[model samples]
Target: MNTFFHIWKYPILLALLTMFGLLAALIGTGVWHVLSWITLTIPAIVCIRFGMFPKNK
Candidate 1:
């Protein structure tokens, strides 16, 4: 339902960005590999989601 997507937006956006970064890295673009590596980790996104937006009850 709608609720699920709202709760999982972070994971979804992370996955999409990860895919884009990987593709950019594979294409041999400068600086993309560095960004790709960053997106692949969890720490980068943890604060972005929970820190900025506390979940509502």
Candidate 2:
């Protein structure tokens, strides 16, 4: 786990941040309205699974 984070932390952070930023920036536009919430499920689930809970050792 430590090794993984040490090597991929930056890239993971960048990718997730970019995805979230793009998602947030589209709010209110026509396409945004179209995908407005459907696309949100990915990040929402990611956060819930990783950010909110971790498996026991």
Candidate 3:
């Protein structure tokens, strides 16, 4: 149980889950292009918002 929780910890798990959701939306769509774009863009925005790239201080 501890190992399972460790594997599903935040950051990695969140990113992985978002990636899976995006892939699912892309591959499993019929008229949900907007939703797919939103899903993909949200993670990117989150990364950017949280300073994914380190800045020189």
Candidate 4:
């Protein structure tokens, strides 16, 4: 259970962020759009960070 949570944590967070961003963009204006952009960019930033500087194992 602990291992499962540990492994799935970031992915779940990213997925939730993506969902919120999409919903925010679809359902509102002004500040919501900005919020959506920020939320949406977080996952992309995480991906780019991991992709560009992976851990050496």
- The sequence of per-residue lDDT tens digits that candidate 4 reaches over residues 1-57 is 699998999899999999999999899999999999999999999989889999786
Q: CA lDDT of 40 in candidate 2? A: 53
TM-score of each: 0.51, 0.42, 0.44, 0.91
Stretches of candidate 2 off by over 4 Å are 28-57
The C-alpha lDDT values of all candidates are 0.75, 0.64, 0.69, 0.96
Error (Å) of candidate 1 at residue 10 is 1.8
Clashes of 2: 0
Question: How should the candidates be ordered by TM-score, best one leading?
Answer: 4, 1, 3, 2
TM-score of 2: 0.42
In the order shown, what is each candidate's alpha-carbon RMSD? 4.3, 4.8, 5.0, 1.3
1-57 per-residue lDDT for model 2 (tens digits): 699888988567656755765676465677665554555565666668877798675
- Give the lowest summed-lDDT range of ten residues in model 2: 33-42
Q: Could you tell me how far off, in angstroms, the CA of residue 55 lies in candidate 4 after the best superposition?
A: 1.8
Q: What does candidate 1's lDDT look like per residue over 1-57, in tens digits?
A: 699998988778877877877686898766877877776655466768778998786
Give Cα distance to truth, residue 31, candidate 3, Å: 3.5
Off by over 4 Å in 1: 43-57
Scored by TM-score, the top model is: 4
